[model samples]
Target: MFSEHRQRLVRQLPAGAAALLSANDIMPTNADGTMPYYPNVNVYYLTGLPEEDAMLALFPGHPDPALREILFIKRVDQLFVKWLGRRADKNTASEISGIRTVFYTDEYWAVMKRVLPLCSTIYLHTNEHARSENETQTREDRLLLACKQLYPLHRYERLYPILARQRNAKTPDEIALLRKACEITEKGFRRVLQTIRPGQTGMQVAAEMIHEYMQHNATWAYEPIVAFGADACILHLRANESVGKDGELVLIDAAARHQYYNADLTRSFPLNGRFTPRQRAYYNAVLRVHKQVAQSVKAGILIKDLWKISNNLLLEELVGLGLCTTADISKHGAQHYLNKHCYHNVSHFLGLDLHDTGYHDEPMPAGAVITNEPGIYNEEECIGVRIENDLLVTENGYEDLMKTIPKEAEEIEDLMNR
Candidate 1:
């Protein structure tokens, strides 16, 4: 799978160009202790190896076939292995990455000297996401800076745009991994439903979800949002300290990561295993919009259009609930009323990362996966409801990856009460 991904990337590159991707640095938290290392997703996408201080270089037009693909890894020693365990040996690295050419990190400069002369352009990878606010210099940053200093005349190109375009549409193997991730997430949600009680703290509920994920050899794709009642109104809420009241709704936007692929899911259910009248009204409204928006996921549809459709459906529901009027929508615009209850967009691309990379303005392609989450938060009523499911775009329509995960109000109540 990794070899096929690398081949696709190589085919996109120009004939005389070379590209470089590096593994993430082991960040330090305090003295002697380091934070858990996560390899750069792009590097992991091209090469299945998930270790720090590793790099991949691709030069499709290189004269020697052996020199076209190179995998550089950390050199192992007795002292380092004693502390950090054994790193991948050459044969192991070759087997994992499907690249026969493996070299030590210390020999990267020597290998680059031989490879750089044959290429006129060097593709440098960087975090180009609009939301990225990375201040610390990464391994890729250092390598790119050093490359410019060494070879000032070589043209440098940004590799992020090409990678973003390619990674938007997942392959069959990636879809299978994603399906496994969603299955693990379903287990976690079921556990939460079975364990949740009226007096349990949000943190306790989050622990239950994490326990289920860990038991399945998965980890949190992102920080779990286990918000109770009014806390759910605050998007990206991480402080899971509130206690669940009997009639209040608890919104959990948690996901599990399997083999580096991610599954994002959100479910809002009542603490007492039944929603209050107002809570059910808002929850059903959000579910209505969610189901409709999901049906619109297919090839050649812009994500922005889906947002527009969701907003329209949600506006009609808001009018029915007496929260907003059609006159207000006509005068102040639908966004004005929609913003009162719904703060975020309806969907986002999902894959290796929770908010995966993709062209939002462009039409979605087959094999692309996105989240359909339409939420309504009423601060005055202390009612927050959100329903999220992963949708895979197909030639005919979309596949609801989380369809089996209970989303309907009666379904959730039945499972929780049982």
Candidate 2:
């Protein structure tokens, strides 16, 4: 399955373009303080090597498989293992990744020196692609600068676009993992429905979900967003402290990660375990947008095009709710405030990363897994509703990975109220 990923990546690169991908920097906190290590997804996707401080270089034009791909990782040490838990030895890394040629970090410079001399155009990866918000300089950025100084005459090209285009689609094995993630997420949501009550705070609900994820041997795909009442209006709200009122709604945007595959899912329910009349109207509208947008995803489709269609669906729904008039829908009512309300687009690539790393402008291919999430927020009404599901594009239309989860109002209400 991953061989297909390699083949796709090879086809996109220039005939002689040798690509280099590096893991991200393990961020530092205060003195002697460090954040939990998270492996970079792109490097993991290509090599299936999960350790930090690793790099993969691919010289597809090379004549032999031994010289075609090279992987570098930190040398395993007994003291380091005791300090940082177990580390993958050379043999273990090679076995898991299917990369035949692997070397310790100490030998990386020597191997690169050899590869650089043979390859003309070198594709170096940097965090230069367009994204929502970014501030930290990546390890790849530092290497890119060093490589330029060392080999001034070597033709260096950006590899971000090539990889992003290739990663936009899903592979069969990748899709299977995503499905498992969605299944875990569904279990958590159902658990929440059973445990939620009017007086409980959103934090309590979040804890229940966490327990469920851990029960299924999964971690959070991203930070769980458990917002109640007006707090739900904050699109990226994390702390789930606010008390859930009896009549208001609770918006839970959460998912589970199995292995490294991620699932992005959002489910909104009433604090009283049944939707209010007004809440139902807005929630159903968001559901409609989600449904319509999902049906449009297919091979060779563009996310930007579907985004436009989704915006129109939101507009139409807003008009129906009398949040704005038909003239406002025609002009710039729902579309204008979509960012403030929905905050994010309906879709993004979902894989090893929750907001998986990849270029957005490229066309989505047949194997790619993406999220179709559409939402609406009304601060004044203290209502926020978002419905999200992971999708896999195929020769036909698309496969909804989260389809097994109850989404319709009646089904959700039955589950919650029962």
Per lDDT, the best of the predicted structures is 1
For all predicted structures, in order, the TM-scores are: 0.98, 0.93
Model 1 lDDT-worst window of ten:
238-247
lDDT of each prediction vs. the true structure? Answer: 0.91, 0.81
Q: In candidate 2, how many Å is residue 151 off?
A: 0.5
Candidate 1 lDDT over 232-297, as tens digits, reads 898898846788888889999999999999999999989999888888888888988998888888
Candidate 1 colliding pairs, count: 0
Which pairs of residues have clashing backbones in candidate 2?
169-367, 169-368, 170-367, 170-368
1-418: candidate 2 lDDT, tens digit per residue: 5556666777777876788888888899999998988987788888787788889888888877697878888886889888988878888888777778889887887888778777788888766546646776778888888888888888988887777666666667877888899899999999988998988877788899889999989999888898888888888899466787788888888889998888888888788877878888998899889988988988777877788888878877876887777776557756565665666678877787676655566667788888888888889888888888888888678989889988999898898878
Backbone clash total for model 2 is: 4
